[model samples]
Target: MTRESWRTRLGFILAAVGSAVGLGNVWRFPWMTAENGGSAFLVVYLAIILLVGVPGLLAEFVIGRRSQRNPAGALYRLSSGSKSWGAVGLFGVVTAVVLLSFYSVVGGWILRYFLASFTGGYFGSPGQYFGAIDFGLPAVGFHVGFLALTALVVVGGIRDGIERATKVMMPAIIVLLIALAGWAVTRPGAGAGLSFYLDFDGTYLRANFFDVLGAAAGQALFTLSLGVGTMITYASYLGDDHNLASDGSLIAVLNTGVGVLAGLVVFPLLFATVGELTGPAAAGGGPGALFVSLAGAFSQLPFGQPLAVVFFGVIVLAALSSSISMLEIPVAYLVDEFGLERRTATAALTCLVLVTGSANALNPGLFGFVAGTLVDLMLTAGLAGFLVFVGWVLGKDAVTEFSSGAGSRVRSLGPAWLWSVRTILPLFLLGTLAVNLLALAGVSLF
Candidate 1:
């Protein structure tokens, strides 16, 4: 059987960008920025994205395009059948499954909220509404529904499914977010939210530099969808004609813009309507609390019902975009490695996630562990492994792959990028992984 490839360059770019722009940007990024010194966290995050994120992205692209295979096969073939390196790639496959299990639970919550918005179902008691539906059987049903939607797209093959869906979804997410941000900033008392998000506090940044750096780096990698082989799997379908550097940089910029735009919308709405930005009931109170707070804020507005519909609709799209990518990783692994058909791969993985995700939905303690601590560890470790493989294993060949289809200026930075990936970047990732592991074990550096 022949391999699938993206139909066009634009299709490929949109699909990749869709994968990057997800709940990480819309749900987590805004709250993280507020918790970490606002604009100070933003500054560090932008630096990390440019310095670390792009190069790491290009590394996956190089390996993927060079091999034209899934992560496991790509690493195996590229490393002369090194099973050790192949396992690293397989680890990414596992990470994707782990990610989707908990992520789908959240996706289900978003789907429920989108539908609820139309009828204002949660308007009476937003906090109580969230508590009632956040777990157990109802949550499990929604998780299955959300997972079904994700599988529907993956079973369609490359161009018709993932590529086609993202082109529409990405545009809708961006345009809706921009509109929301514009309306949000004009509300009374919104200036306080804008100040909270945009105003930099140098003293706080200096005092809590390490804390801010760790949080910023985690969010940067997560928002980019690195380490889980989503990028690698996406890149494997590409032709050498695509400029990996240019495409990667554009994806990062667009993803960051959406994250900032989410803050613009969320912060102002919280300030103007909810009149709070911190504490257990505010942006920092985790996803359930944030959703409840935002829902309450929507209920208080003039065109609140329609605005709620649009806002939650944007989140649903964002969640679907990333979920599809997560599902694709393991599906690609099976199809590439075992000659399973796309539909067969999709069905098998979807069923597996259905069971795992239900476990998460029915158990709050398990869900929190997987969603917060477990995911952070897996993504960090997975990216570290990928960087080491690209640097030490691919070595000069990595540069050759990166330079292909790139301009002179981009080509010129190949060696510097390689050195960073090989040395500095791995160290950075490993350090982040250590911090997360320690935190999981009830140890805190800060």
Candidate 2:
């Protein structure tokens, strides 16, 4: 059988964006923004996205499209006489498993909340509703259901499963979000929310510049699906006909737009209802925020139930789209390296994740560590390795791949982009990684 590829360029773009826009956009981005200095943090994050994120994404595309293999195989083959390079790629495979272990559990919670809303399950006390359904056997069951949904897509292979699903999902997610943001902005006192979200308090940023920089940089990479080799794997499916630079830029822009749109709805609603919108609850109930608070908001408003359905439905699609990418990393590694059948690889990986994800579902501290700090560290390191490989190892070839389908304007900029990736980007990532590691050790870079 021939290897599967995306049916069209739009299918590929939507699929990549689907992986980019997920719980990171809906659940975590708001919380991170609220905890940081709000708009000041947003500004820094946006700057990083434009400067660092786009180039890094292009680097991944270069590797993926050039090698046309899983990260492990891509690295080993792209660099001759380097088993260690494959080991670096294996780290990404491990990262995917670690990412999905907690991600699926959270996705499961979204599934649960979606179901709960229609039945008015948590309508009585919205505050306690999150706690009630957060973790237990039921949570595990729903997580398994969500995991099964993810597995089904992976089993369906790239074309039938990932591409087809994401093409529909990404559009639906955008449409629903636009509608929600429009509705949210119209509410009385929504200006207070917008002010709180958009207020640029320089003092807050000046006070926590380094900390915010590290956090925002990490968020920008993770939210764009840059570091995990998802981009590499996705790009591997591309034929030599596509322009990697254009595709990378499009994915980054669309993902960032959706993330900002999410903030627009969430911040305004939280601020309009109650002043300031502090802590995890306002941003997200950790994992439950989107379902719980949004559901609460819906219950109190007219047409709340229908709107609740739309919100959770969007989340379900977004979560699945991203989760499928996560699952694909390891499954592809198994197929490419171990020569396992795709079905066997997916099934075996799904079972392994069932155990790993269940552990995340059963424990809060472990889940927090893996989902928050661990993922940040892993993605940071993974992306740094990819950029270094492209910048130094594949330096000339990287330029060629980048300029292949790019217009003259973008192709012209490839050299400068390559220079930055080689020197400046790596240095910045190393510094951020050191700070994050030290902060984890209680050294307090801030």
Candidate 3:
């Protein structure tokens, strides 16, 4: 059987953007923004995205396009059959499983909220409503349902499933978010919310520079769907004609734009009704803060029932599109490395996540740890290793891959991109890795 590839360039772009613009954009990005001094965190995060995110993204693209294989196979083949590097790639496959375990649980919650919006399900006592549905058997059922939806897409293979789904989803997510933002800002007293979200407080940034930096760095990587091999897997399907640099930049831009747009809707609506950002509901920005708070806010607004439906509808689409990417990583591994059929590979991996994700839905403590610190560490480590491999191992080949199909302007930047990826970028990732590890160990040496 031949390997699968995207049917069109637009299909690939939309799929990658769909992967990048997930729940992080809708939920985590806004909460992180509000909690970490609003725009203070945004400034730091934007810097990191340009400095770290784009380069890191290119590194993955180089590897994926160069190898045209899944992470494990890519590393193994690229390094002249080095089992050790292959181990690192296999770790990525594991990381995807770990990621989906918690991610699907949240996706399930979003799916439920999207459904409930139609009937005003959580319109009463948003906080209590979240507490009721956040964990245990009910959450487990929803998680399974979400996992089923993800698997259904992946089973359809690349173009027929992932690409086609994302083409519609990406557009819907953006258009609806724009409509929501327009509606939100028109409400009375929305200017204050916009101010809170966009105002740059130099004092707050200077005082909590490291705190904001670390938070921003993590969010930057998380928002782009980096450190998870999703991009690597996605790029593996690209033809040599598609410009990786251009596509990557576009993904970063669209993801960021959507994130900022989500803030437009979220901040104004929350401030308009809820009065202020209700952060710290759980560590690393919880669903409670975004989901429950917004649910309550909608309850207060006139015609909120319809607005709630659209809002959660966007979330569901975003979450599904991203989760499909997450699921694709390991499925690509199974199919690429083992030569298993795509459908068979997807089924096996789906069953695996079903059990793992159910554990998270049933246990709050486990979910918090996996979703917060554990994911951060895995993505940080996974991406750092990829950058190091690109620089120290793939090196010139990485440069060639990056330059392939790039415009003359972008092609010229490949060497500089290479130097940074080889030295500066990995060091930056390691520095952040250390900070994450320290924070994990309860040592706050920012």
Question: Which candidate has the highest lDDT of all?
Answer: 1
Q: What is the lDDT of residue 12 in candidate 1?
A: 87
Tell me the TM-score of each prediction against the true structure.
0.98, 0.97, 0.98
Off by over 4 Å in 1: 277-284
> RMSDs, each prediction?
1.3, 1.6, 1.4
TM-score of 1: 0.98
The order of the candidates by lDDT, greatest first, is: 1, 3, 2
Model 3 TM-score is 0.98
Give the true-structure RMSD of model 1: 1.3
- Candidate 2 stretches with Cα past 4 Å from truth are 277-285, 289-292
Clashing pairs in 1: none
Weakest lDDT window of 10 consecutive positions for candidate 3: 277-286
lDDT of 3 by residue, 179-240 (tens): 99999999897888888889998999999999898889888888898988999999999999
> Residue 134 deviation, candidate 1, in Å?
0.5
Quality of model 3 by C-alpha lDDT: 0.89
Model 3: runs farther than 4 Å from truth?
277-285
Q: Give each model's clash number.
A: 0, 1, 0
